[model samples]
Target: MFNLDQAISAWRRQLAAGGIKTPEVLDELESHLRDDVEQQVRSGTSEEQAFNSATQQIGQTNVLKVEFNKVGLAKWWQLPIKLKGMLIRILGREQPFPFPDLNTFTPRGLQTLELAREEAPRLGHDFIGTEHVLLGLMKSEDGIVLKVLRKAGVDNSAIKAEIERFVGVGPVHEANMAIPYTPRARKALHLAAREANALNHVHISTGHIFLGLLLENEGVAGHVLRNLGVQTETTREAILKDLAGS
Candidate 1:
């Protein structure tokens, strides 16, 4: 008695009410829901039962709507499309710039900052993106990158306290500050710059930082990226391919 099509239609309406307005993103979400419902139906559940089960397993649509809204501006994992919009407002033109703050950066993040300075103006942007923030932390002398490094496996405060004992200081820099870069780090910065430019994206996003780290491909930074389940070559290639088609 459960009408699968009816249920999906209702869910789509729910998403729209919650401000998930992009048709493309909605289509992908719908496809996922349909796949879930079909799997439940194939497992011998009645249509109604399958519908109910699939919907429940998918969690509340309202909550998902909230998550989608938070994705671009608030989420640390990915830069929201608002960045592109902001750039458009600034330039008074239609152009896409990546958001920079979303980088899951380590020490190598500083390189991203240098790259941004070199590239942001070229992209005709006045401000940097979240990806740049991530890179700034990594390259900053502010001891943030070190904190992230030590805190990777355990409590961050504990690592800082231990470091203070050796350095006789709270931390080398404040949490929101960026550190200076060395020649080697500068070279890493250039690589990130080149990669961003090659992508033709006006601003950088966290995804770009992932690519930068992969291009660096060394030491602790690379190891952390591997653990994070980032497939550098594959993701880079996929982004490039998508850009090409677009």
Candidate 2:
């Protein structure tokens, strides 16, 4: 006699042993497992079969851990309710931002973030700034930012030249040293989330990031764009149009 509750508990322990240790994350994963098992059982699957299927669908423990880590799972959920509420309000949201448990970044969006981190070091900067993010967006060949720039007849090389000129090389740091985001860069990320929410998009992309840079118009990226003849409103409209058409 296979017991579902015991089986699920054992499965959770396996996940925990495999490094999916955060309580909230474990609870969330268990909830999903239960839902899947319940649905499969309703479809006449045997209890054992349903449990096995659910575990497989939930994915391997190591893979799930990697996915959760990518989204900063622990920090995001550990935020104080009041602070979370304040962030929601700041993003112009009446409700909490959607899918708090899941990563909102598309593949390209994640790549852009990684590239931005790389760009900061390549420029010998100790911190990631909006300028690095701008370079990241441009460097992402599949990003919508490049599409918009091309449509606007703005040269990518020109933008790179401007960023390099404005943000000259700084003292080099150790290659293994962890770089942090500047205040404006952090704000830009928040704005990117807001842009995704406004567009009813579950996943944030390079286009949303570009909009974030535009919204943070006091940043170095904003100044570079302005100097190169990219109007905030017009660029915004163009991005919106492109997204809409796509």
Candidate 3:
């Protein structure tokens, strides 16, 4: 008594429990699974056997979760702000949102993130904050971000000094240990992807990252920028101009 519908339902529940909770994503995965099973069945495999083979082909829950997460962020970025908020409310705060893959970032953009990660430990902090991201943007040379900052009369060295002063130094942690992003930092990155998408860019760039930091204007980076007399609108315009030119 192999009940195909019941078995698919059970499989969907398993995926949900394994962190594939988005309804749209779940539906898409289920569709793929069904297609695979149907193909096998058409080729003469028993229905139950086809089901098992399809599940195997779909991949383990953990691997599927990671792949879906990578796709999720891009899809999330395309969502309108209001729709995103509504979806967030429906999903609740208990589930962790998926972040985009670093591979989507351009070389200089990836460098900024890496420098931010390194800056956290160098500053004796165990977590990467928006402030660290600011520092990383400053440290990155020859990037359009630095060019925009220079055009805006913002001194990179001064910004770095200010961030260090604001954050201060925490107790030392192991350099090799992975540091997680603070909520603000994560939001900034999400905004960065959104910024790139708005411009119809396929890859996230350093300028987009800077714009992300600026958009998260209540964060430490925003506070420091304000203290330095840097206007968010002006800086945003400058970054946009640079991006357009390049």
Note the Cα lDDT for every prediction shown.
Answer: 0.46, 0.72, 0.75
Tens digit of per-residue lDDT, candidate 2, span 57-172: 66788866665554423233223222222222233322222322227788888888788878876766646678888988888867578877777777779998988887676545
Range of the 10 consecutive residues with the lowest summed lDDT in candidate 2 = 77-86
Off by over 4 Å in 2: 1-102, 171-177
lDDT score of residue 179 within candidate 3 = 51
TM-score pick, better of 2 and 3: 3
Q: Native-vs-model 1 lDDT?
A: 0.46
Scored against the true structure, residue 209 in model 1 reaches a CA lDDT of 48
User: Considering every candidate listed, which one attains the maximal lDDT?
Assistant: 3
Error of 2 at 6 (Å): 62
lDDT of 3 by residue, 100-148 (tens): 6788898888888888888877766656678888988888764687776
Q: What ranking of all candidate models by TM-score puts the best one first?
A: 3, 2, 1
Stretches of candidate 1 exceeding 4 Å from the true structure: 73-211, 214-246
Query: Which wins on TM-score, candidate 1 or candidate 3?
Result: 3
TM per model? 0.35, 0.57, 0.60
Q: Which numbered prediction scores highest in TM-score against the true structure?
A: 3
